[model samples]
Target chain A: MRIPVGTAVAAGSIVALAIVPPITEALREPFYLGLCLRLMILAIAAISLNLILGFGNMVSFGHAAYMGIGAYVVGIGAFHAVEDGIDWLANGFLHVPLAIAASSLAALVIGAISIRTRGVYFIMITLAFGQMLYFVGVGLEVYGADDGLSLYMRSDFGDVLDINDNTRFYYLVLALLLATLYGTKRLVASRFGLVIRGARSNERRLAAIGIPVYRYKLVAFTVAGAICGVAGVLLANRTDFVSPDMMHWTRSGDLIIMVVLGGMGTLFGPLYGAAVLVLVEEFLSGVTEHWQIVFGPLLVLVAVYARGGIAGALRALERRRG
Target chain B: MGEPILRLRGLTKRFGGLTATDSVTLDVVEGEVHAVIGPNGAGKTTLVGQISGEIRPDRGRILFAGQSITRGPVHARALLGIARSFQITSVFLDFTVAANVALAVQAHAGHSFRFWRDAASDDALIEPAAEYLGLVGLSDRTDDVAATLSHGERRQLEIAMALATAPRLLLLDEPTAGMGGDESARMIDLLRSFKGRFTILLVEHDMDAVFALADRITVLDSGRILVSGPPDDIRADPAVRQAYLGDGDT
Candidate 1:
């Protein structure tokens, strides 16, 4: 129990991923590689939102907008770079950093406006902003409108680091996800984390105790946006495509579902939730075209039966036993 | 007193037709226990709210430590060493007693930007938190979940947590509200022991505790000051006796 939950989770994931590549390659299974990579990216996205919703008590419904912002970054960058023969520094890396910056900037503005209201209003406003982003993504002609754009080639990390190859791409995505997980763990545990948690527990108490709750929550929101932006980039790279689907409200719901399914507020829970979701998607889809009919009911069950999600329920059980 | 540590001048708050706090003015010297006593509907809690920045006043200025802090928000006021406890025992019930106090310690230990280290493990945050807990007689129950504590004990924990901020002016809003006679007396004794170390602004209805511990008693009726003086002077004031305490009674 003394062991940091974040570190333990990161270690377990790395060890599991290390065994996956060789096993998949020997079995001549290329699709499983994509599935695993997709899970990692989604998990990373879910965890970013978890920092805000779970710990900060900020239920942002527009979280998928960051992911969309990130995808568009790569998509737009690749289009300009490929067509105009722009340099790597100009066309490729340009979009990734810009995406994160845009998302952070957007979060600052949206957070400012949304945090002015409390309870249900906050959730509604965030979802509204996310819908706006989704519509905007659909309207963009440069990125193929509703069709989505694909990268003809991956972002060059230099001559040695081609993202076009599946195995190399998988490792790179893994590294970034781990880094994000580590960063989030550090950010939450810091003095800042304590403040954020205090604000979440009781904003009035925090204010009386000498903390600017609104400011701390806004900063945490921006951090979550930036983190989600990173996840978006990995997601776009893994799929080799970008679409307005990335910013859809349902996508935001998916993120929330993953967070709640794994366990809201628990750092490792998001990863587990993401992994379980992708596996369920694969298994369900293999059975029939309308797997969602089955998946939707299962989610309802999870929500109804487990309000605290898996981790909270497990903790309750442990306490009962002890 | 030379520059009362906290001074409230002409503070008023109106709710539609209801005057929650009428033009109320009060003062607390650097090391005096100034008690405000009033009936249930006399705007006692409202006065505490206006003074603590929870409810902004429609009019009037507040000065803390010789400087006007009328425009300061709750957090800013708290940072300037003003700490207030709730009349209804408010605490971070989900957090452990130590974690609850540690948050107050974290607020004052510079910025909370230090990441990658466990905040609970940091001696800087923990030691001060522990010291305050010990002061409030909560040292043994530091690890206990605050929600599980008895109501009176939770009140003590609130004081300990508030003290962790190293407040210059401690505002206690009915610290003995829900306590039994013995618990209430013990709480009063604890507050009595805290005299001379920090300024206290106590708003309570308990006549025994108020009269016994107060350096100066301020009586409020209909959101206005009925009278304010030393216990002997306040006790004999006929107007106070009529407005608050009926006929020869306290």
Candidate 2:
């Protein structure tokens, strides 16, 4: 198979990650595992946003709301189960599906209204929905309110899987990331994907050609939300906590930044973006407490120099070689 | 004429006090190139918009294939065999020419909700896409990015995409608006090739193309019809000459 250099780079990175637990253990650096896990989960979220923002051209600024909703599903389910001693509600297997379904339903309602509007109106409405959800989270009296709720135990995956173990959990997240990438690649090359991408370029033209572009956009929005929500379940497991701040507007901005910085439309771009963002945050914090002061300029450089982001830059280089 | 295949009755649209299309009534036979011609701001574009469902008329009824479609959505009208090309050369600039046509084909072929297969390689989509591209004489430019094509080629690609939908009526809004002399001629030749095979409602500023291709002509002046008849009749009518063709200028 003739794999593009970028795809190879992405696969190699995943393979390198597969062996990370041993290397980090040898170096006595357990923090690397947590960082890698965070990167994978955030990558999932970025990919979900990419489906709408990059492909469908629906600039939703409230994507993090779904992630927060997904994480909250786990937190609320676990809390209620623990409080009332309900087995089915507490099951991790059930929790993941429930979280995805809840997030998908939320996306359907929000997308139905949000997709009706375009450009800045779309962005504003999405941000409004996000803020509404954020306030709702803060208003929950039983769920620890602003302080957030902690999971008493990590999700149980039966006797075969122990999510508490770092190596196993890392592999699980990695596998899901790979599957998401493959599935998304297929999706974007499918008929549905063409309509989504076509709408991005000329929505009016698409409508004239007998395609109901809005309905396709709604479906894409829902799918992205469902995917991101799955990532939220993983996030709650990784951090063992859920809070309203997770779905704040700034968090949504970060997801947008990830999509743009990595390469908005390319499949593997989000993974690179998530890795770069998390690594930069880690490195900057290590060097100086006020990392944003240094980091803000770096982002501006990427914005100015990389018109198509990193993936676009790589394609340009490939074109030059030929 | 056994109920014109397409009919517009009392179509009226107003932007505040300014009327864009005022009580416009028209009809199109099953297989004839019915041309709409007028000067700038004569509401040709607005009339096309109302027909295509982009601009909802304040008062009107549109019947396509003998069914009232005044409130039909743009896509629904398109699916009912009415395809329109944009006046300002709208297209998917980033896609390849073939891909642009393929997307149009995919839109009408079946449910676009299929998410698992690679549509780019599906022969069901690609085969007809190639056929349509060839029909527009864009077979050579199939792999070229649409944005890289010349202004004339982009317009041709637009027509090809419209044709891929297999529409019964094609609404072309100034398909040769920005073309040079040679490009405009080529477009005329292309449209002529489809004569009598597809119903066309053409809005144009090129008097030569309108006269050459239109079996019948409708003249619009300030959002109202001045005349609608055969091309020779339009040329002879002194009122049309003074208002639109400019008094013996033709």
TM-score of each: 0.94, 0.97
- For residues B1-250, could you state the per-residue lDDT of candidate 1 as single tens digits? 6458988899888888888777888888889999998777888888888778888899988889888988778988899999999988889988899999999988877766666788878898898899999898988999998889999999999999789888999999999998998889989999999988878999987888998799999988888888899999988988877777663333
Candidate 2: where is the Cα deviation over 4 Å?
A1-4, B1-3, B247-250
List, residue by residue over A134-205, the lDDT tens digit for candidate 2: 889999879988888998766777786898888898889988998999999999999999999999988989
Residue-by-residue lDDT tens digits, candidate 2, B9-78: 9999999988989899999988899999988898999998888888899998999998998988999999
Deviation in Å, model 1, residue B162 alpha carbon = 1.6
Q: Which parts of model 1 are misplaced by more than 4 Å? A: A1-14, A89-95, A316-322, B247-250
Candidate 1 lDDT, tens digit per residue, A240-261?
A: 8889998999999999989989
Clash-forming residue pairs, model 2: none
Q: How would you class the docking of model 2?
A: high
Clashing residue pairs for model 1:
A191-B112, A192-B112
Candidate of highest TM-score: 2
Distance (Å) between predicted and true CA of B205, model 2? 1.0
